[model samples]
Target: MSSNKLSAVLEKQIHHLCLKDFPCGYGTWRKTKDSTEGAETEDTDDLLDLLSCRHSPWRHDKSWSPQAPALRRLAVLTPERLHTDFIYNYFTTLRIVDKGVSVIDDGLLRFSKLEELVLSDNKITEIPAENLPSTLKILELRANRLSALNSLTNCLPPRLEYLSLGSNSLGSHDDIFHLTGRHWPQLVCLDLSDCEFKDQRALLSALSTLSCLRTLVLEGNPFTLAPSYPGFTVDSVPQLSCLDTSWISAEERQCFRGLAKNSDLIVDRASATVSVGRARGIPDPLMRVEENAPDFPVVNYGYFITYEFLSHQTVNLNFDRESKSDAANVIEDDADLQSNRNCEKESCKQLMVYTEETCHDVTHVSGHSTSKLTWSECMDFSHTHTYIVGDLGGLKRFFNKGLYLTIEEEKVLSWPAASEDVPLAKPSRPVKEKKSRKGEESPIKSGSTKDKSKDKKKKSVPELFQDAPIRRILGSVHIPLHSLVTGGQKVLVLCNVGALQTESEVEATQTLEKDLGKTIKEDKKKDKESKQGGGSSTKQKNTAASKGKVKGGQECKMDVHTDNSVSVQLEPVTVEFNVELEKWQSASEAHQLLLPQHNSLSKQPVLS
Candidate 1:
């Protein structure tokens, strides 16, 4: 509508826009004024106008072709003039996100060859299908005002492979009906996360029609809170390789198979088994010899486990008492872990620790001298804890507060030898009689400094192994609860907890360093230009700046050194565990009598 003139905001953002690749062409062409843009797009065979060179308009019929005369002076115009301009037809990809676009106007239809379009984070309420390019293969409209697909689904490109409609208000059952194979037959990956879609049955029934859908994300939907959710979703769409963010495992697929058809078999309080398996590539901390050791050294190292889980507490009331005479004596328990307390403050964030006393010792190949541990034996630590979840909402909360597991390398210096002849002086009097006499004779002197010193020594003497061995925190691994919640069965879940590292984190630090380096250079340039009045002050400032830089570099080096020496150097150890939810019958005898239906569920097909 503005002809060839673009708005001020569009002009500023125009340089960031990119041109799509030609069919069977070399590569994509970027429209940047920088020299690198030409180098980057030089391999392409098609001619591109990076300077927005205007050309005469060509006819849309048989006169326009790839080898048209007007193509020699191709006009790289703004996206708003896409309808009037003929040169933009060469582009196959268009991205106009966060542009405050409220409507899908006729401007986009001009790019007849556009294969991909990203219009996310806009105020688009409805998409007129006629305005879309038929060649579009991927369209991302996430975080938009789209409420329904009735208008858009009618003329959607047949070859559309990927569609992302997340963070929208498409909640109705009719909206789901439009998302079928009949509309987008070739649709492979569909993202419908963070929507208002309710009714698990209706959603699954509608999505089941998309036979080609390989990856489907239905996270943050209202139906996701149902106990039979992911189980039902998985069974409904068996063709999916991924759901939410997790990939479907063979065992998980088998567990939740045929669950959609059987709705009554959904679990309330599910059971799980957690097992800590053997670790590989664990370094022997005692390999480096220390001073003043016994002839034979005793090395002690083991695995420690810690995790946060949800546990339900119930209260019972007495009806015979005068205060509660009106209340009923009989009480019933529900599988749903419903609580009237505030979820923000009381969401069960309890930490459980399996200490050294409970852990089994790791076998050394050649005792303390061994550099590596044997792989055949189990390091020995496993636990099974049951969660009392009423619905998928509780499970979701548990997932948000992920399972925090830390793998610590505990080491002991030495164990005292039995042959060591440590002499102990015999007491002059009976210990109990002496204590009774002292208490009687020195009642007034009980608060004396001498008695206090003696008491302090006595207290400190019993604290064994205080300085014996050093405990180093190797690293921690966060285990996601998605598998636990979505597994949908009371089975032994084996989880491999790998040793954590910092290599993946270096990229962030590197980018930060680059940004800081640019700012430092600019600051130095400004300082040089401003300090023309004095030599002493400038010299002092230079010295101070140099010292600061040196100090910062040293600090950075120390941090990197510590990280490399501790977490990065340690090889990844495989810690396996199984977590199973306990049965409600085992929890209480009264619950067993009340949950008679649970016994019959095993005979039938269970979903959750």
Candidate 2:
């Protein structure tokens, strides 16, 4: 321990140790107390000394690997931070991972011999180019909130070859140009993976300029999510030696090049590649479009992905509420309403929102789908089938809670994978009695005890991929849609159409509910008469009457009327799909090198 430079304080209280003695391949990875205590180091001020004598990136060539000067490695990953800066010119490699760091002290500028610096898993926002030692060759800044690349202009060291800016908020279209290799002519690898990049064309355009780049990572972006992604990426960027985590295959290159020639042919966007496989029990790191986001579930039928959710309890669109009158106040001018509508769209110009047209191509990786339907807040029940109307009872219960609660969230929506032609297996739908109430009262029986128990046990899910985009789109866009029904079909409706509960809606909801109740009562009368008079003969006539009642959203010319707090009377459109994993993928071995391997002495963290 003394030969390894343990500080006097650490030599005293350190109960657990993971030391990488010099001239060794790997170090100990142990904790004394057990898993509950976690793999955490305390008061890391003494950690700097432990790393001072360790040489990282042990090379085949005595003097070097392109990673760093084949010697003098140091990593101080103590989350308990104390000193702001320290001068250590003798060390060639340094890592300060997850040390609650916010600022890089000027002391690092004095590390004239430093070749690599890792400040990942910190709360840093910007990396001032001025203070970085010009002799440094690599930098890792993952999991930060960095947005500006202009700060790095002309600040990169001349020999810098590897850089990682993954999991940051560099989503704006303008940041593409900042990635060029003009500053570091010797640049070889770049990791922009999981950054919020939606436009592939712009990203590819900027990447092509890096003539020296051999490796590129663009995973977790929406653009690369399509089926033709791998092939197209290999086709467009001929210089890439590696795309994402995999090497550019010669067969994949030939395949996509031929497909690129024909424009009229629909590019079959399926089954091109898969995500890195996850090792069991070793949880994959969480990646998000933005930190702490949420998502709505999109169930993909055989060919359609259905995104279903309900509206706010009180939709305050206030669209048609110019007057609150029994006094017969004339409605506002059409021009005034139109102008206000235009203002709504304009005011949301700055937020990062997804447009319908843009999101249309956003494929849910679970399965291939061609169409989707969205639901809105307000819906009229009079037009729907008797069965769909009954489904609204659950919606009423949900809306009454004044929160987002729906049928889709009852179980874990895991997509393991299945054939494209074969639909994903779904839980069996309980067969309900063939009962109808003329589109008035509830039709569905409460589900099985097992299902309700399972639902109750399912804990709140943590942040996932869909949550990232969902939160982004929901943040910038106003209004809501899609609520619960007996079957798994989603209802599509318009958001802006919901206005304050007007006299029309109040009167309409009341009249519709009464009319529906009468229909149920009348149906019973007909059934009784048919059973008594001519059971078999009148059965066909009764069935016809039930089927022909009414259907709306453009067909029956039925009035649209749903009160703010009334039971739901919405339509259900079925979009069938099978659950499939977007093919779970783990980070590449090369990606693991993005930071210093503190415990691996033989294999120091280095660009491969």
Which lDDT tens digits does candidate 2 get at residues 99-207? 5566665645766778887777777777778778888888888887788777776477888888989878776676787776676578889888656665555666677
Q: What is the C-alpha lDDT of each candidate?
A: 0.53, 0.42
Model 2, residue 242: what's the lDDT?
A: 90
lDDT of 2: 0.42
Task: Give Cα distance to truth, residue 196, candidate 1, Å.
Answer: 6.9
Superposition error at 47 for model 2 (Å): 18
* Model 2: residues with Cα > 4 Å off, grouped in runs: 1-87, 258-608
Output the number of the TM-score-best candidate.
1
Clashes of 2: 14
